[model samples]
Target: MVLNLGGFKFEWKQTSEIAIETDFGINSQERIANFEALLSAKLGSQSINLNGQTLPFAQDGQEALKPLYALAELRQSLPLVTGLGKYLGRFAIEKISENRSVFAPNGAFFTQTFSLTLRRDYDADIA
Candidate 1:
């Protein structure tokens, strides 16, 4: 897995790419005023796609559906610890979007795809 959100894993097969974005939140005035100063900066938001597919070699489709289920059950009110390679931080799940896919007779899904939008939680007490 290339990334780990909370306790859910994002396998390389399921992920095409991982993108992390940072917004300095520096306005035009701030930039001009602090041109010679070492201004403070804030972390911005990030998003990722949690994609999975059931492989024929697998015994069941549960492995493909586990991350989807976990994301659906997550509480947006709380912040979750996330790690991507060596980067680690506390972030809140700002939004979640899922794409439709086929399912089996036993309710097992053939594929699971989700887009998660997260924002850094700056609160110091959010452990």
Candidate 2:
């Protein structure tokens, strides 16, 4: 599967999971026997977990995470690309955590695993 966050293309690892959510409201009013209102569409945000993956090449640890760090700092909407399709809108970077597994000769992290969370933008289109 291919994933594109804004313009950054990520290399997928062997293991990954995609979660999709939909919300609805059930009405218990005495007038109606049973009624359900669609609170939201399948347009709900998707949470993806890219567990245990190496960071892209860079001069050092900081450099490798520079782009990702920038995205985290922006905290703005971004275009999200999924294998099934593509979504254009705001995507907020929820989190970015790293785990160092290997070190370079200069004592910099050569191999590191990073986790990221992105939230989709909500608008009237879903309603």
Candidate 3:
């Protein structure tokens, strides 16, 4: 597995990317960069996308994807305890896209392609 978020393991499949964005304020009079907005990086809003495919070996495609569905429905932030190398933070599911292809005799999916978009959840309570 490449990473485990909140307890759901992410196995190798396709590709993953992490994105970080920042905003800066400028002084019109000085014509130069002035100050950065509070939480300029938008830590809690930054998101990452994980793409993968699930194949039925001993279990159906729907069964293999149950965990992911559960996580997305929770609508809560979860801690990052393993993988993802040096980066450590909380995350919440922002979106989930799945494509099911190939079907079994009973109509269960044989293979499923999925993409998970997760938003960073900053631990700080900025009030």
Candidate 4:
């Protein structure tokens, strides 16, 4: 399915790939992890805030990333990616039974197709 708001669009499918996957289907932490990883890889060699602490990278990049970091955090807490069109007036997402997704925003068409099965991180568990 595809829903287009403004110019941005989101198309969901039923693929066996999930770069941003979550078992709870509602846990916010997984989203946070995804965002943090993206920022780290995409914004490498730059200084930005992660969670609370400031992260200074070892590369050059756009100055606006600082703000993007904040936005990412906020979005992590209360995700609006699905409805970005409503707030920013441009975006879309098709709710399907797909484990994978392709996010094309602005001039960057990011595609992440992951073939993964579910396995609880028992090692990270702490009681």
Quick one: best TM-score, which candidate? 3
lDDT of 2 by residue, 20-124 (tens): 433333333344566654343343344444444554354233456567678778777676776567664556778877777566687766577666766656652
TM-score of each: 0.57, 0.60, 0.67, 0.19
- The residue-by-residue lDDT of candidate 3 on 1-127, one tens digit each, is 6778778876655334444442243323333467544433332245667777776654333677788789878888776544546445677888888888877798877677777877766653222
1 versus 2: better TM-score goes to: 2
Q: Which prediction has more favorable TM-score, 3 or 4?
A: 3
Clashes of each: 0, 3, 0, 5
Question: Whose lDDT is greatest here?
Answer: 3
**Model 1 spans > 4 angstroms off:** 29-85, 102-109, 124-127
Question: Ten consecutive residues with minimal summed lDDT in candidate 2?
Answer: 21-30
lDDT, candidate 4, equals 0.26
lDDT of 3: 0.65
| Model 3 regions more than 4 Å off | 13-44, 58-61, 81-87, 124-127
Instruction: Give the alpha-carbon lDDT of every model.
Output: 0.54, 0.58, 0.65, 0.26
| Residue 124, model 2, lDDT | 22
How many clashes (backbone atoms < 3 Å, residues ≥3 apart in a chain or on different chains) does model 4 have? 5
Off by over 4 Å in 4: 1-18, 24-61, 72-76, 83-127
**Per-residue lDDT of 26 in model 2:** 32
